[model samples]
Target: MPAADLTRAALSAARVWLVGGGKMGGALLTGWLDHGVAPDNVTVIDPGLDQGPHGVRLAADPAAPLAEGPAPDVLLLAVKPQVMDSVLPAYRALGGGPTVVLSVAAGRLIAGFETAFGPGTPVVRSIPNTPAAVHRGMTVACANGHVTDTARATCEALLGAVGDIAWVTDEALIDAVTAVSGSGPAYVFWLTECMTQAGIDGGLPADLAARIARATVCGAGALMDASPEDPATLRRNVTSPNGTTAAALEVLMQESGGLGPLMSRAVAAATQRSQDLAG
Candidate 1:
């Protein structure tokens, strides 16, 4: 079998325990099912979620019964960072050995899981954005020393089901990654909002402004994804020497008080916040 097929087959056979079934968790569940993971082999635990997809077991809480079955092959943590501390203890018993713990919670570190689940636990700390709901997300992951190659593949397969995946040896880089792709979708959404408002201020109808702004952002993102050329090249391709795009680019590309420096500052702030949360 091809490697991708083999990975999906392995994922299908693995018992996956999804610890939170909110938006991100739900997205991952959909991805997993689409990638051939058996619904019967997956379990979702969330007090807020009254029901889950058909054939998948759902639990209101991590009751004693949850620990009754064979240890899960993969324990995916998708809870918010604010509540992860309290949630981690409840599932501590599920860690270690064959069961790799994959976390999507922003700013939660592998050491925290290792400490909560035991030092021997294999923990993969990852940052994924909301775009995963549409299978266009970008995720960056770093694994602890205990994660075996096989366990890493399982984690990779699960993440790949949603979107693109990249691995890094330096866990510190994850904070930067979190600042970039993890929080990038929000920036794009804000850009759309700004464009919409700008159009309205420039005399366009409110509804039309919103429609065009939304379409432009979405379409540009799609174009970038489908293009072989780098973003800079694609950008330059549309910018005539003295045209409208160039006029805008002159301001945005300015060394001081420009989009580039502003974006750098924003990313730096986010990176710092990520580091703070990890503490």
Candidate 2:
């Protein structure tokens, strides 16, 4: 899409109300603000917001009617899964128009939204990681049948304000998305921790090992993003016959059950948990 088109699609009719202003909501709000979205067009409805963003109104309760503002063009539901029911009734009162509701709560489906907002309300379910705070997150979205092409575009634009957006036609894939990118950052952090411990075990000072491990992961990820080649090609380029990297790979990518299988199992377990939560 053209840059102007993308921007226009993203912010058009863009009066947005965020129902929760926790970490993920704050990340998205900051991103949108950084992208030149007028703070006046955004409202945060978090009771816990100690201080409001400049120019944006902060409300302690979204349960109350939208006090004199334009009906929201987009409603962002960012509360935890368990509290959606409690918080949804107030938002639902404003759903009779062309509003598109986008939710980031894990394990909730479009059907759950339909239950809350009545059928025919445009709903988009998304999974976004905490990395979004830095504008490097990956967000995956799925639209219910009620959502129009324009609504999808709008949703994409809103998510793109933070980082990348990928749409999935199959809603079932969203559980996998939750397992992967949604929960994947924690996994990567664990990997960093493990590598740092290994480095320390290999005789490096603890602080030095941690710093090296962190930088290595960040730098390698940046390099991978910059490179045109696939990761396998990149790995092959770094591995010499009988080299140290190759030796490590022998254990990580072993024949029977190695990192690949372990990761597959882990992702499957997470996907199953997401399904259970949705249930």
Candidate 3:
């Protein structure tokens, strides 16, 4: 089916049972509610939920009866990776249905879900960043072979509730996703921090420098997102003959090895570590 049709199907029929009410889960819940998903359709099961917005049902334990009705159409596992085993049993009754099981826990794989649930259970694993808390998250998801087209569409819809979604057939690539977008936000924040320090060194006021650094990066990212042109083209448009930006680019793109190679190494290291964790 077309991606658009899939999206529509998802929005029309998605009934989500979110297991964690932490930052990512709360962000997704907010996005869904904001996007017209009936709060009555969402059942959040989180022991730590001290407070929740109106319309959605919150439960401190999974054994509690759902206020909406029966089991959810989709079960979203958002709890921490370490506590997944403890949380799985509570939602196992839903595993027998046509429901799609979706997880945003880093390093958890499809096999792990199958073990916790039952064989042939449809599963979609994703790596989402904290930016998801603000409805700007980038999610990379992959479904187990047991997942059908409808199941995949359902998973996509649940993920789209938060932000952008990308599908991958190869589960191994999920590790790379973990390294890139999953951890990518931290890299951006680090850049902001370094830029602020540079401004400080350049003798700008501390507060002004911090604001400038943040606004520059945020604006640059928004521009990149809005533009049809490639990032390299956009970057070149900002550079001029012997200009300060060019000088900085020259150092950043040095021939021997520069930020590009250094970042590549960092991503590779992170990817390997994700694989290790999954193992």
User: Which candidate number would show the highest lDDT if scored against the true structure?
Assistant: 1
Each prediction's TM-score against the native?
A: 0.97, 0.96, 0.93
Model 2 C-alpha lDDT per residue in residues 33-93, reported as the tens digit of each score: 8776778888899999978789987888864537676778789999999998888988777
lDDT for model 2 = 0.88
lDDT by residue (82-191, candidate 1, tens digit) is 99988988887776667899999998988888989986889999998889998877999999999998888888989988999999999999999999999998899999
Error of 3 at 165 (Å): 0.8
Clash count (model 1, backbone only): 0
- Please, what are the lDDT tens digits per residue for candidate 3 over residues 180-238? 99999999999999999999999999999999999999999999999999999999999
Per-model tally of clashing residue pairs: 0, 0, 0
lDDT of each: 0.90, 0.88, 0.85
lDDT score, candidate 2, position 252: 98
- Highest TM-score model number: 1
Give the CA lDDT, 0 to 100, for residue 194 in model 2.
95
What C-alpha root-mean-square deviation, in Å, does candidate 3 show against the real structure? 2.1
Two-way lDDT contest, 1 vs 2, winner: 1
Off by over 4 Å in 1: none
Question: Candidate 1: which pairs clash?
Answer: none
